[model samples]
Target: MTYEDLPTVPRAEELVDKAFSRAARAGRAKSGAEAQRSMLQTAGNILSDNLQNVTTSWPDFDRVDPFYRELADAVVPAHGDCPGGVDGLRTHLSEVMWAGRQAGHIRDEYQSKLRGVDADLARKHRKQAFARLADVTREVSEDLEALGEARDTLKTLPDIRADQPTIVVAGYPNVGKSTFVNRVTNARNEVASYPFTTKQVRVGHVERDHVRYQLIDTPGLLDRPEAERNGIERQAVSALRHLADCILVFVDASAECGYPVEVQLALRDELADRFADIPVLTVCTKADRSRDLDADAYVSVTEEEGVEELLDAAVEAVDYEIELPFEG
Candidate 1:
């Protein structure tokens, strides 16, 4: 959705009030399951930016070891004693994962499943084999349980229906904050490699597992005081005061700042004073290009681990609830 689709701030505020009023009249279902679901959905919203990184990576590791263990239970006797049994099982399981299920209802159908075997001569033995499939079935169930747990762990991300999480990406000019948002969110916001490419604050929705968060890509850091008649710095100041839910302070932890870490820390201090209530996350951008950037704080790896961690932090925002007598 675009700016046009979203109500103007004043209108949106009015709607929120109206919504709460309506909610007040309805009886609340304070069930623990309901609360757990709401919280997980909300957390999913905050971590939307990093959900793929976390959730996708999770199932991969989560399923692998269990899948191999299950395979060992099923295949060790028939496929007895491969030199590196676990490793071989892992390789086979990887292939199966990539292969996915067979097409359509045939995937669930078992009639033609033993097609490759010479079943005509081995019918009774086949019956005996089917009876012994219990161990394999049990192992398969265990593997599935591991994958389910991983998905559930991600599904339990923090969320509250009334207030959504917001992450403000602030940094020195050209630190790839916009790119980071795009990578995690599949957002199409414009990005440039120049300082101050983003003059205005652009808010994008990062939704994961049905939860939503507002990812605010703000202008670069404001070094000069507000009193100084300024340029990009002023835009940054405006974003600080008005737009962010939580501040993600992006530093040139790589020090393309042309200055020193002292200057960066001073800037951070100034920002803290200005936006004292907003939580600030330090982000060190430009791992691909700048090696000189030193961040004793959270460092971003040009575009990989650094940006990934930043997104996880964005997802980790706390949610608040008023415990309304009517919430369901």
Candidate 2:
């Protein structure tokens, strides 16, 4: 699921101000005890509904695709003041939800207290309820701020479609992975920065036989050894594991990418071991410059040579089957 549609989380002060302002208008429309009751109901309902909306606006982390779930966890800490994790984010949401319910309870209690009271007494009950609701809201202000930060971070994630057959390109920097992706896919390929990493992830698409395949080039996460990567980068790589149908390990045989062929091959073997369940193909890039390394396929983006064949190999490795409808 895409995070682009997530609603902006409202701050506590903003929510309180909005609810009370709207409640005043409702009170102006009525008279006496009824007016006070109307004002209380309006304000309470606004706070409860808005706080609940903030909680519900976030996609359930447990039910979300693992790729997005872990990626979000890596980028945003669960609590504004504590460490980051899915459970932490859930806790913040839970607090906000509880606050919403408390607002409703306060409304009901004050409404009950207003019964048989005169205009002034009813106004006093309504004011007390309003103060209580505001306090409840203020208590979860940190949670609200955390959710808002999460929304802002998650919304910026690259729109990678988990449904599509994905080919993850892995190699050292300047190994021609990006060049190959650009050459093979349409002009719609996107280069988006991950909030957790300084590097940018390039996503491109190619369609064949009416089925679309996504090519992803993740720089910092996949270009190095597992032990060399930081915790956040490792988590990011773990997230990619869920999206990869096929992994293309690009090896620059010419060593012009500034790494020895041996190092590149070692990374390939490491990935092969890590993603043993998925198909991992070794590709020798920069074929025009040198074809010294043995690989499953060879491609040279400079001459636009063998690029389509390599893409075809990745798709073939994916071996995605089209599901057909059954007729009884």
Candidate 3:
């Protein structure tokens, strides 16, 4: 699930306001003392319940798949706004929960203080109790705001399935990688005629012999070192490193994609070395305008040629991990 689907966490002021608003709406028709007690109880309940819900709704990083957990670990800690990373978020959230519980305790304590006091004085004490609760709530305003910021940052994360056999397509800019994915998977993932057209990873699914494979189309590669990669590219690299069962590196032989054959080869070599543990299949696109590329496979999307070969190679690369039933 995308982080956007996660529950919303209200700011401290908002929570306090809501709790007080609910308290105001609580019944006050009976004895003033009883009415004051009811309002405090209602306010405490509202505060505590809202805090509890926010804590519970957060994604449990411990229980999630490796991909998401790792992704969270990578991003949350790096968030400049979130002081404690994932643990920090947890700590802040825990503090909010504690504040909620304390608000309830404060209400109960003040209610007891109201026991022998006159109605007007009891009303004064109730306001004092709410003020104390609000103080607690306000103290953690930064934490609450940090949590909200973290949520916004996390929502942009791509939703990728960790259970499936996955293939990642990587190469320099404008190498027909997106088009290749569209043609092979029958998925209408966005395709444009410019470099870095795919700013985020696009996922598609195809079933070969009932064994599903997830195809990932990554943004265009840059001819630079990994250490120098920007945040978006680093995220792509992180996902690819953890999730790729196989990688398909494409090259443009005709130089129509702007980068020359040699530059594209350097990129392919770099990817092959980087993901040395996984199988890397290199395919030369733009075969119709071929200018001699020594690739493991070649495909011309415009002429609709060599696509089957590319698909066949992809299936074979993934099929190695598939355990077929033996006929004894």
Best-matching candidate per TM-score: 2
Total colliding residue pairs, candidate 1: 12
By TM-score, the candidates rank as 2, 3, 1
Q: Which has the greatest lDDT?
A: 2
For candidate 1, write residues 1-328 as lDDT tens digits.
1111111111212322343333233313333233223322232222221212222332232343332232222222212232222344344344223322221122223234333444342343323333332223233333333333323332322121224666667766676777777777645567876667775555667764455777767667756666772434554555456446677766665566454656766777777787788777666666555545444335444446665556656666434233448756
Off by over 4 Å in 3: 1-5, 73-95, 138-142, 152-156, 320-328
Clashes of 3: 0
Whole-structure CA lDDT of model 3? 0.79
Instruction: Quote the lDDT for 228 in model 1.
Output: 75
Q: What TM-score fits each model?
A: 0.44, 0.88, 0.83
Which whole-number lDDT from 0 to 100 does residue 55 have in model 2? 86
- lDDT score, candidate 3, position 50: 79
Candidate 2's C-alpha runs over 4 A off are 187-202, 222-228, 256-258
The CA-based lDDT of model 2 is what?
0.82
Per-residue CA lDDT of model 3 for 169-257, tens digit only, reads 88887899889889888566677787777766677778787788888887787768877876456556766787898999888888889
Model with the higher TM-score, candidate 2 or 3:
2
Off by over 4 Å in 1: 1-163, 229-232, 257-259, 288-303, 320-328
What overall lDDT goes with each candidate model? Answer: 0.46, 0.82, 0.79
